[model samples]
Target: MSVAAPPPSETTIADSAQNPSMNDLVTEQLVSSGDAASFAPRTALALLHYDVASTILTDLTPNELLNFALTCRSICNVVIPRYIWAHIALTPKHPRLQVITLLRKIAFSVECGPHFIRHLEVASIHVKKPYLKCRNPWYLPYLFQELFTQMQNLRSLSIIHCDKMLPHLPRIPKAIVSLPHLRSLHLANFSYLALNLLDKLSGLQTISLASPTYNVHEFLSSTTSALQKILVNSRHTLEEIRLFEVCLNVDLIPSHHGSRADADTNQELCWPHVHTLELPQCIGDGWAPALHIAFPSVRTFASPEQSHWWTAALRDASFLTGLESLHTKSSVARGFTMAGYTTRRLVIGDDMPFDVTNTPLKDLLPRHLVNLQVSLWSSYFDPTLERFTTVLPMVTPHLKYFFMRMNRGFICNTYHNQLCDIVDDIRTLPLEYLCITWDVNCGKKRCDRCVRRSCPEPVAKYVERRLPSLQALTIRVDENRRWHWKKKKVEEDGVPAGTLSLMSPTREGDILREEYAKRIV
Candidate 1:
């Protein structure tokens, strides 16, 4: 029986968390007192050259990178010279003093280190008072100003949960305008008054506004004018916008004394380069941008609800001529299908317990769809095996990319014939990339029937034989593990020849479903 390993214990977790970086392992001893830089040729860590190791180290967190640097002098030198802190993600859960210390180091660094930091994400930086002994009233403002002003070369900045930070660090708006290289900005939980810098900063490429915890009506109404001004100023350079729970009021900004528009009327503006837009669900909500704006180059559109566009360009155009993909819920997808709207790429992620529109796909799906992504996170009481039975066969055989996340009982582990039947259904797809993550219940189950027949390998083999154009296959049998099969070979490590890969709950994030969609505009 080939069984995956059980979950890790507390001691094993404590030991593994200390050495998290995937940088080439440092050779503790070069076997000589004077040759600390050299490694034995036979060592596995010796395989990666210095440049590759340095590049890989950039992926580590600030703390992890520092810990890895402490291993040896050679690695310490590498960390000091390179742009290892190009990306920094800070959350309230992180040690406050440690983060402040790192920020201070970057601000005063002699390596021009602050210039190398391209992306910064500060999430939920509000209301969590630090327990530090230094109780100076001006401490946060000074620290933030020093750190932010020195990051003049930053490319992307994401600041969320900062409604309280404004009271302490009001100079952040000025600091944002000081960056010449900044193009992407993400803000959440801020008032319209906080967005005055939007007019001062132009040439932005991406803007994402989210208000997860605020009143929708109040936030939207307050931010509409500021949002419109920013859009008009950055029209030439803006390429993507993602709005969550903050939709612009469809009416034009009521004339203010010295606003950008003239005398209660404005000229039409066109976003000639905007390629992707993700708006929140807009089903029965009564707000659509009333501005005379056009997104002529929008290639991908995602909204969770039905939409009614009143913009002159959208209303006049026969269809979204440039749109290649549509992402929405099952009910909205059905509405689009019923309205005769079709696209080559489609994504349906409806997390409803019972959706009547879900069955419409059983009878018809867009025949020309080249890429399909479906999320069946239905109730655990009801497995999506039935939906799979109906929809998988309907997908075009010529489709190239397919992604699905579903909860099916360990029927594959207990009933081989049912697994074979499921594989036979989707076998005709000439899929170049296929990803499936089977969502299992949290409860325990035991498969005592000598495990090879109870595992997913036989099903994968059956799939590989049935689909000739298959290029890459990834299957996550349970939450903790996934394996890839290519060229008739399965990358199953640390298990018997009969078993799949050992379940590494300690590894990293879920590898099953993150890569199915293209992100960049």
Candidate 2:
């Protein structure tokens, strides 16, 4: 029997080796198959337990990071500790109950509630109802106190109160007064209670008070001592203060004759480190001297387009010595010559009419200006290329950035002619960047022609040919409500190569291509 079995040929053995049993095939498939749970452990996710993985996770969006953590238990352990819930914004558009419930859910996490939140903004929509008021003022203060109590790392807080609810809200709670890390506070349409909160926050570096409900003079009168205390405590840390539409009363400061008491009192209230002061139009002449005395180190001042504050500052040579930036209208710029003002940056509003013939751009701008922005309503009477040519030589020594915005209606052929001439003159300046935007309504009758002519190719070519120091140029033309924009970068050889272009109503690309071909021909 053994000899007969050994007689099995090589073919028979080979056939047996080529074929496998059904149980063996099923076992092999079971061993190789993997689900989400098995795949996650075998991938790079196992490395998440290391510190290096947290750095990569920090770049992911909040929702994306949360979804990733939900994939498996191992990933959740590593992601939860690395996630930072830094910014939280709540608006009235969201259901009140839903927002509150979500906030409560976040606060329930003991480890994240206090350590993660950094910036919090709460804004309510402005609703004008005849007889129904949905806002409960009592609920707002309680909610603020509860949230502030839980968020220990909050640095910036913005609260926009409803106009109808401002008068009924309670005083700022003690919870807000004791935040050690809070540096910025923005309060819009707030009541007198905000002053109490402000008094205790001496470590704040940036404070913006906008559209206060109470009279400015009365509010300052009640908190003069507290204000003095804050100045003494935060003088070194406070850098920026913005007051929008809130009047400043000079009478709040105790003025003494040239006696030791005056020196001692001034020393206690001086803000020696404040560099930026944004004033409202309500600030009067009396407030100017007080501001000069209080904030002697201020170098940048931002005011309304027509406020007389800049005029008052201009008269004080001592105050104007350190002034570096002026944000005002062109009308205001016209009254003051550039001879004495040391301002290096000027931002002019578009509402004013700048007559190049009358004002002469050379005289309107300071010699030391490094940045100039002229936002004007250009028309037939706007500045000409000759005026720019004349002025460029005078200011080119220091001017590095120029932004010109022309907002007009019905831009005719003359406008483009003037634009080409201006480009010819721009080639001579050592500008670092130039941005020109034309916002106009090209009638349907001329959209096709205007779109072709407004290619900005001529301007780009001019810059490439003449301007050697120019780095970047941006030109935007809006025709019949459609936007067309192009940006170019000047290479080391001084030729501007097209970097980016966007044309709406996508079919315009074909028209632009045809225009380019014709120009080449």
Q: Write the per-residue lDDT of candidate 1 for residues 1-521, one digit (tens) a residue.
A: 01112222322212222322322323322231244443332222323554455456555555454433433323343442332333344333546454444333333232323222222322111223322224454554575566566556677777765555543466777777776777888877765666655457778899877763444466554444566677767779999977766544431222121225453343335566878877765323444432223566788878635444322224323335456887876665665555555677878866432232336563334666777777654443333345453355564545677777665445334444544555566777666667766654333355454232234676567666776666556666565466665442443444334322323342321342344455211
TM-score of 1: 0.67
The numbered model that scores best in lDDT is 1
Every candidate's lDDT: 0.52, 0.51
Cα lDDT tens digits for candidate 2, 193-249: 545455656787887666767665664545553333444566678888777765454
Instruction: Identify the runs in model 2 with alpha carbons over 4 angstroms from their true place.
Output: 1-86, 91-147, 162-173, 217-233, 250-261, 280-282, 290-292, 303-312, 331-339, 381-390, 409-420, 445-466, 474-521
TM-score of each: 0.67, 0.65
Candidate 2 — what's its lDDT? Answer: 0.51
Model 1 gets an lDDT of: 0.52
* Model 1 Cα shift for residue 242 (angstroms): 0.7
- Residue 232 local lDDT, model 2: 54
